[model samples]
Target: MRYSSITDRLADLGSEKWALHIRARQMQASGTDVIQLTIGEPDMPTDPLLIAEAQRAMNAGRYRYSNGRGEPSVVNALTARYTRRRADVTAENVLCFPGTQTALFAVMLGLVEAGDGVLVGDPLYATYDGVIQSTGAHRVTVPLKPEHGFHMQAADLEKAITPKCRVLLLNTPHNPTGAVLTADEIKAIGDICRKHDLWIVCDEVYEELIFNGPFASPFDDPELAERTVVVSSISKSHAAPGFRSGWAVGPVEFASRLLPVSETMLFGVQPFIADMTAYALTHDIGTSAAMRTSYKTRADLIVEGLSNVPGIVPLPPEAGMFTLIDVAGTGLTGEAFAWMLLEQEHVAVMPGSSFGVEAASFVRVSLTVPDTVIQEACARITKLAIRLLTPKERRA
Candidate 1:
């Protein structure tokens, strides 16, 4: 049977991170001791308090379909949190989804039409490309340069925008690069969007994982509140990817338009999960703080270890759990280096080409492993680098 063109559009949706993850799992199943750093999932287990709260909710028989927008408590908690950050947010402006991925996709589909241009920075999360493609929209890229600390500038945005462009997708504390935008940078970008009359889909899922000072959001500016849809989740912050709960905050009209799309996508988040998530949002849970501290330590270890290695250059991460390493000096493409590292050293990492053509000379390493594992991975990488670079006649 022939499928719709949408199926063809999704042909490239499989991400290299997940591909490496599956390969690593297959190797491990075959008894190989692989140190997998390809995926960004936290190595730590879910917080016990969250687990207990979930259990309590289930025991109380809270299983039922909730309002498609969200349960009142979850909505209220999110509303209060965002309102505290920026005075324009309220419960009516929030919409919950199964995950931030879905929230982002829904927002894109709701706002952008076929042939419309969605401007995104290059070296972006792999899924963004697929999401934009699935909507039959154009994925226009603004090149992010390393000299500028990988932050997107308003000047670049102005240059990238065109008559067809309708949306600007921004990710702070960015995945793969770990580049966080400053408040001033966000304001500049927002100003550009305002001039172009473009909507901003701010992916702040890694907001809580920042190593720097306080997290900054475009919504912090009330003027941009009408044009911005903020997508976030506890997947990274609380280490609860399996729960698949996330939310989007925007102007009331924008959120109301997104709700119907969300409803058609997945009625609502599971009620029991919603209850636990609401509790998590409202309370001062210490899990996120603890995880942040641990991730910072791990980031330091890996950065320092890779710095001593000869061929690879590890960029120091400002926030988020992954670091991008320039692998061009090794005389290998990111894909070739990733495969060689996995096969020869039993260490897995994501090829930078998975993100964008601009990142083809790089590879992303996740700091999800423990300190010892990170140390060992670095050692293996260094040894492999030496072997690959050594002259054959010198070996004897």
Candidate 2:
């Protein structure tokens, strides 16, 4: 019997972040005190209303095949949610999926061909590269500079686009940097895409997670609305990662194109999850609000506490639960700094390289832990940064 070597796409991809997360979890399981800030999972519980609704559905024998597109109520509630945000959405534009990750993959597979180029931001969501590679498309990363506050200019995006540029991937408030793109900025990209006949897939999974300022989106432009597919989920908003509920919204034609790919991949997303998600979307406003407020408070605490630490610049994030610290001058690589923090102070942070190529000198710290845990982690990191930055002779 002969086994096959993995394809180059799978063979070449590396996931240091997942490995670190797994190791951290294992260490914690062994009773070691590890402050995990690597993954983006919410620490809060699922919305109680959703739980109750799911129980009701189960009791009513609602276990059956889902409409491949999604539960009608789920789609309607999603339309209501997005319309409230931007006023341009309708239920027909929505496509439901088991998870935002799955929705995103479906969008990519539907839009791109083998060897077609896709533009993703650096530092970006790490899983994006894998998705692009497996789709047989080339990943062209547009660097988001620290000096520019991780904001990409329109001209920069133009230069990154080639004839093969089939898709432009965007996220806001961005994961590591938390830079939210303004409406004007979005239009600029929209204009470019419209000119070049390129499609877009905006991953707004963190849209509701904004910390400061109003959210701006490419979908806000009606001109680009048809070509743009927005992928979002209930996981972050409701603290229900296990629920596996998400949706994709675009013009009916574009939505229709993506649905077949999704159906082939998943047959359909779980209906009970969709039913629960609809209940949560309609009735769990309080849960989302409370979690948002909680994260905002945590963000403030970490930013204020870490401000006093020298040689580390905490770029204030406008949204999302992450902060990217400039660790270039620490005379240590981001990975080294992260491992040192883990070993010496027992705090685990994801290295910025996990996101994109240009974030090598930065490290992302998430605010998912409790406030006490956050304070403890901050103090520990403060001490570590001080030691690393302070002169050896100054240490008494």
RMSD of each: 1.7, 2.1
* lDDT of candidate 2 over 232-278, digit per residue (tens): 89888788888888888988888877788888887767767778888
| Residue range with the least summed lDDT across 10 consecutive positions in model 2 | 3-12
lDDT of 2: 0.81
Task: Kindly list the per-residue Cα lDDT of model 1 for residues 1-396, writing each as its tens digit.
Answer: 889988888876864446876888899899999998988898888888888988998899878778899988788889888889987677889999988998988998999878999999999998998789889998999989888888898898899898999999999988878899998999899999999999999999998888868777788888898898899988888889999999989989998878889999988888778888888888888777777787788878877888867678888888888988888888898888988999999999998988888789898999888889989999999888877775862363
C-alpha-based local distance difference test score of model 1: 0.87
Instruction: Please give the CA lDDT of all the candidate structures.
Output: 0.87, 0.81
Task: Give every collision pair in model 2.
Answer: none
Roughly what TM-score does model 2 have, to 2 decimal places?
0.94
> Each candidate's TM vs. the true structure?
0.97, 0.94
Q: lDDT winner among the candidates? A: 1
